[model samples]
Target chain A: MAQQELEPFFFRSGQEQLFGCYHAPGRGPKSAARKTAVLLVHPMDQENIRSHRAYRRLATQLSGLGYPVLRFDLYACGDSEDECELGSIHRWVEDVAAALKELQRRSGLSSICIIGMRLGATFAATAAVEHGGLRGLVLWEPVLSGALFIEDLRSAHDKMIRTFLSKPRSTTPDEAGLDIMGFPFPDRLLAEFKEMGLGQLEGSPAEDVLLLDQGTDYSALAGGLEATETRLTHKSVAGPRIWEEDPSAGLIPQEALKAIESWVAETMP
Target chain B: MGCGDNALKEQAVTFGAAAPLVGILTSPVASVSTGKAPEIGVLLLNAGLLHRIGPSRLYVKLARFLARDGFHVLRFDFSGIGDSGRRRDTLPFEKSSNQEVSEAMDHMAEQTGLKRFLLIGLCSGALVSFCAAGQDPRVVGVVCINAPGFSHIIPDSVVAQVSKRQASRYYLQVALSNPASWLKILRRRVDYLSIGRALWNATFGRLQRSKSSASTAAPDSVAATHGMQTQLENFKQRGVRSLLLFSEGDWGLDYLHCELGKSVKQLEQFGAQLEVVTSADHIFTLRQNQRELMNRIRTWCLGLS
Candidate 1:
């Protein structure tokens, strides 16, 4: 809605200031009464590109429901100020933490939730461990294991290289570095990614979690959170694989959006 | 790797009659060149549905690259795209896009007192630049990268058939050379019927051209070519330098060489320079390809100075 305030600004995350857009609730009867805020975690690489529109739409939908939503770019990604080669998962987790603090301060709401897609879901899970008072977590087609995620990235990278390179050479997992599509994948980041797994984490930090399964069966991810003092909700949502090789066929799954909207309304209320 | 980390200054700007268009102006922090500032400004357009970032942040890098070269570059999203507000005018993209681009140039001129402009775009953006150049005499040069179906007069139905023909012909060529293609065909991953159609077209289709002459002899087809030629001739007459870059790997190469026939050479003789990247993707997604493309652009910009 035009009445909704969309503020674009930069905030500090360690030494670098990350770019973010805040979607505040419109001046409605429910606007001032709302206290819950949601911070969106974007998926890595091309998924970010394909999912940009859907995420913006999702933010608008949430804001219309009187929920303040903040969508920010991770360090070295999107419109943020940095190079892709310098990005690391550990740094991005910190970036998420920084964004959470900024969102809390801006919205003046201590009750916060995180909605992450693909790798963003993984980062959210990781950051939730630090912010123990989170309202909920939404993992949209999240990657359960770091190893499998790296494997998928490698496969996509190889296909893209073979398509683009004149003398395309296959890259090995043990290689010193990795470049998926155009974004650089430093070996240090690769090593950090290889060691991460939702199951391996000590516990889930949130009281409730919603796993919006696009296709993958997240029984393992659910079991890990179930072992902790956490309630895990699983919902199957059929949508376009935004992380697929060719993002040209941009498909925003209406079903998935509806599912997310319904879940946010129920959880945040 | 990105504008030497503050070698250039960038600011978000909104301009247009309705102020519906938004762009980022990337200009050098200090004069990088001693000579008089380049007379031309750069306007980067959206390739297709992609935002102003271009495909794979190519526009961002290009803007910074040109800025470091002491040229002001403006990369903007069109109506209903990226962060730009939607247009209330409800004009078709074909008409509104040219007006929006012109507004961007006018914005740059107002900001920096630069009147001459260079239009750089990929795919659909290239077509927009071509159309915009025809409308504005302030456009001194244009760099169209991998823009295939650029004719203004060709009907959509004809363009669709041409695209299909070019795609089919391309796949047929790939199938003949790459064993991986044959393997995909064997595995039913490749559409065999389309391949067969393409093969037939590539083989007997040319030989059977005389029989199909009646179908293609429409007055519209002739007019489309004539229109395209006249546009190029007009650009030449106006002293607007044109650089047409085609990636050999792109289907656009087929459209340029096979579809446009010898008219391509005629345009070149008319003073438009055509350069082909033998091993580059349609979007130039590869970093090296992007570097090469930027270098070519920098050289062209310098030559203009």
Candidate 2:
């Protein structure tokens, strides 16, 4: 089979210019009825770098399966211009909206399926709620609560600091507060983020919502979505968090890919 | 004059300014047999936000290895960090301005009388060295390991903006609960009272603007273009070679390589040799990797002739 062609392009969102790479299938349907587009929203920062190869793989696979895929850098990240100017959930949602519009313009596809990891998933969910026309939502290890995510970041920062200090550092008083990589939390972003629980979004019923949790149970997420009248299908895949820089990290979860490909095939048809 | 083998002295020096400049200075075990062992010195810099103390297994190993390989090594804490002074209240990492870094270089030169000086820095420190080297002609060469270009252009305004943003968010939340807080703020500024308020507005304003326009109006014009550009130009003029080491696994490597590639391309336009090493983390932590890095450095330094 001939390989698909991936084209790199840039689009304007407000005053910022966003970068994206679009992959189109070689043997896919040419008619409007068979055309499909998937937008791959990447995790923030280091995870974005670590998962570059995996994301490329997924984009290729999806394109091969007759779905055009678009992977783009969020604002202030990758080749995109700006320096994290849009630190709020709303601003990121706007970026996602811009990306979707751009995808429609470029590929002539009216609908988009969003596949996101971590905070990217949060953005995708917000976009889905606001736009009301996504084909599917694939969330891999999605962060459900901004407060909890902040706590995790703080813990990681504290752990790193402790390891560096050799002597024990005071952690009790500050444990509750969010401090990531020695930077204090931005309250506006934090407050807005706390309101971004995935279970709370009001949107049209998605064609399918696939939640892939690695090394932990996602029953709560599934239950939360169910309560909100959102149909969610959950699965757990065992693997190391390759988003981290550990050399002995595990490979990308096979089940995660299987679930994604299967969903693309079923949804596209 | 190199100390005779019988008259060699080895010691650790903790140079004190308003801030302590803690460093380990190593010299030959013996006096120079010939003129002076061509006094070559290497300074070590750590990665982003990491202090220059504790075990620093990679740093220590590299320094010791370099020292044994016959290069005098001085690894010190950057200001407001590690054993150095408290963090500077400036935007960006300008604890030591370009002038100050040059002064440090001169001081090191005067203290050691070393003919050749090499700076080996990880991440932000590597970017700092690039800026510092432009100002100081005494620095013969620089080895930047996994440098991040993101923080390279941090301006005082940006730093102040970050702090101000934090303060505004804190105060804004308080304003909601306490009318007195709002009253106080209103009284201070019928319009706007604090630097934080101004910064918060500015940040959003920047966000609201198009990225293409923002790129043209970068936060720090001098630091972004002139600082590194001037340094590369000056290094070329002075015949100082530059080396960049990047790793596939390091988070910041790709961006660093891109920035370095741009700088190198600009320098090459002015006639300069730039060597790029493709395998090494920000710290060159792996034993085999460190050795490979050292060998590459040695070859580059030797090839400079």
Candidate 3:
């Protein structure tokens, strides 16, 4: 049963106009913030677009369970800003902060949990380190090594070109850097990603962190927080790689979502 | 709600009977050379299940480009797609999609006070916009990219089979031409599932398809062509300008040329433009290709009467 309509609006993040959706708690309003507020940090580039259905479904499901959830598009993504070349990890981190501020404004600055996937996991991890102190952190397939992530993107992109197209666009890293699917990542941005990694984090992303394993091992990076006294739990979740093209596959991975939902519900203090 | 000092703003508006369908409006920040906003509105439709962002967020880039150039652009998710909610009614996707296009047009008419709109869509979105242009008098022009359904209605299996055939051929070519491709196969860099599908489709699938085609000539294919002919006639009667944009060598374009060429070619007499982007895929994923596509769209829209 739906209690209220989802609120879709455009908000400002520094100089860019970013698009975001606010899912009001299905059973209750903002009355429950610290315990039920969830902010989703989406994956970047084409991965973000492919995983959109999952994010919307997750938001709806969480809202139904009485959590006010927020889903936002980073700059140069979704209904946000347009230029693909303008997207950078730094700007995306700022976008996360702006979205969190908006979520906090609605939650009266209460402790809000953050759920991130892929590249977004890196952004959330970095944001958590900078912002300091969060209720919970769900790092779903976090990119532990930025260089490895870029290589993965490159290989996937090569496969995409071979599968769908006869001749691909130039990828010599000219002014456009390289084309991943249709999104353009500049060389400087790619260089930035190469220099960053979750292993480089000196502090914990949150007091309690749930790392959903999507076939990627994160124990070494997870152990990096041993000195910070952060509670870390690793859960292996069998879910389709929604980032890849598989029309027959369901967009929402039920098992993975259930694990997260259970973690959020049980993690509530 | 665009922020900052630019005269342009991205406004969020909801329309339809319950005002349930949501759309984002991107408008000019300042008056253009003519000192006022462009009179015609550009309405973007969702490409297949990809939502309003267009394939690879092309619609977003296209929207901002057009807005900055003084045209108002509206991108919205249809009901049950993207951020939009499901319709209370159980209308099939085809009928529901057409209805949504008309509703979007109505919304545009109300917001811009513009009587006419220029519509653009990709794949199935293109089909929806074309159908809407045939029905909605408010549509003066439409740009359809790799639209389907004009192609004969084949079983879903055949679609998958075609994909496998392409993959198999591509793999065969790569395996023969490049030593690295075989190295990838040796290391299993190329997924086994993909190879298996390709082999299965190339062998057993081909035999099955041949036998199936011998038994069935796709009875409705001719009827489908005739139906498209009538629709093109309707478009002409309504003076709706149609632009058929296709990627060279795409299956959709192949189907168009193979099955519905005669009917589609007839539209050229009435200023219906047909363009094929060289070296482009179904979605024109390349920046140069997209620029060509967008430039073509911009020129056609601006030059429209």
| Root mean square deviation (Cα) for candidate 1 | 3.8
For every prediction, compared with the true complex, DockQ reads: 0.27, 0.01, 0.35
Which model, 2 or 3, shows the larger TM-score?
Answer: 3
Question: What stretches of model 3 exceed 4 Å from their correct place?
Answer: A1-4, A28-34, A246-250, B3-7, B30-37, B151-219, B261-264
Mark the 10 consecutive residues where model 2 chain B has the least summed lDDT.
B1-10
Pairs in clash, predicted candidate 3: B1-B10, B7-B29, B8-B29
lDDT of 3 by residue, A1-269 (tens): 22226888888898778888998877555234436478998887778778888888888888877787898988877788656677778888888888888998875647789999888878988888888878788988888888888888888777666654456556455466677767787888789888988887877778888889878777787678665768988899887867664422337777888899889888963
What is the per-residue lDDT of model 3 for residues B178-249, given as tens digits with 9 covering 90 to 100? 677778878978888977877777678657655764563354555665666777777788888888888865
Q: Rank the candidates by TM-score, best first.
A: 1, 3, 2
lDDT of each: 0.75, 0.58, 0.75
- Poorest stretch of ten by lDDT in candidate 2 chain A: A162-171
lDDT of 1 by residue, B90-172 (tens): 78888888888888888999988899999999988888888888889899898888886566455554565566666654665
lDDT of model number 1? 0.75
Provide C-alpha RMSD values for all models, in order.
Answer: 3.8, 24.4, 4.8
